[model samples]
Target: MKKSYCPIDTFINVVKGKRKATIILHLFQGDKRYNELAKLLPDISERMLTKQLKELEEDGIIDRKAYPEVPPRVEYSLTDLGKEIHPYLKGMFRGGILFEKRIDESL
Candidate 1:
């Protein structure tokens, strides 16, 4: 089947996945290394994390910088466009917390 990459669906494509948003949410705190990101989001496979990072970089939502050292180091952080979405992400997080509380209360 052919997948449609519509303009309206582009944002969802980038931000609506488990690993993708998890990566973005954590990085809101600061830059993160590959292993640090993997540890922070332990459920994600390293391959998935790598793929998501590349996608985000291609979309200009995140920047990856590699430093030369004995073992080499790479860190990922939000780009200006990514920072623009942080407020929305914060609100989403707050809303999710409230929704979970409501579910707990009902249970």
Candidate 2:
């Protein structure tokens, strides 16, 4: 398939999944274990969660660290690139809240 022509399309491609944005937002709070993430997004199915995490990791938006221990442990955190996008996400969030409020008032 052809690559995206627009910059926003490229960004959207990286975080296209339903849970991807929420995952990134949660990681903004702090690094989280696999189970922790699952807990944070209780509505997501395990299969879907695994898929989105893999996509994020492949896109270099998140880092996955596995610890060598009795019980395998995995943690996910944002990369430098991911951190760089935080301000943009925050801006989108504020705008979204205002947009929602406006819609509510209009209804």
Q: How many residue pairs clash in each candidate?
A: 0, 0
Q: What is the TM-score of each candidate against the true structure?
A: 0.81, 0.89
lDDT of 2 at 33: 98
Off by over 4 Å in 1: 1-9
**Which prediction has the highest TM-score against the true structure?**
2
The lDDT per prediction is 0.84, 0.89
| CA RMSD per model (angstroms) | 3.3, 1.9
How would you encode candidate 1's per-residue C-alpha lDDT over 4-101 as one tens digit per residue? 47854666666876578778888888999999999998888888889889988888889999999869999999999888888877887899899999
Worst 10 residues of 2 by lDDT: 1-10
The 10-residue segment with the lowest total lDDT in model 1: 1-10
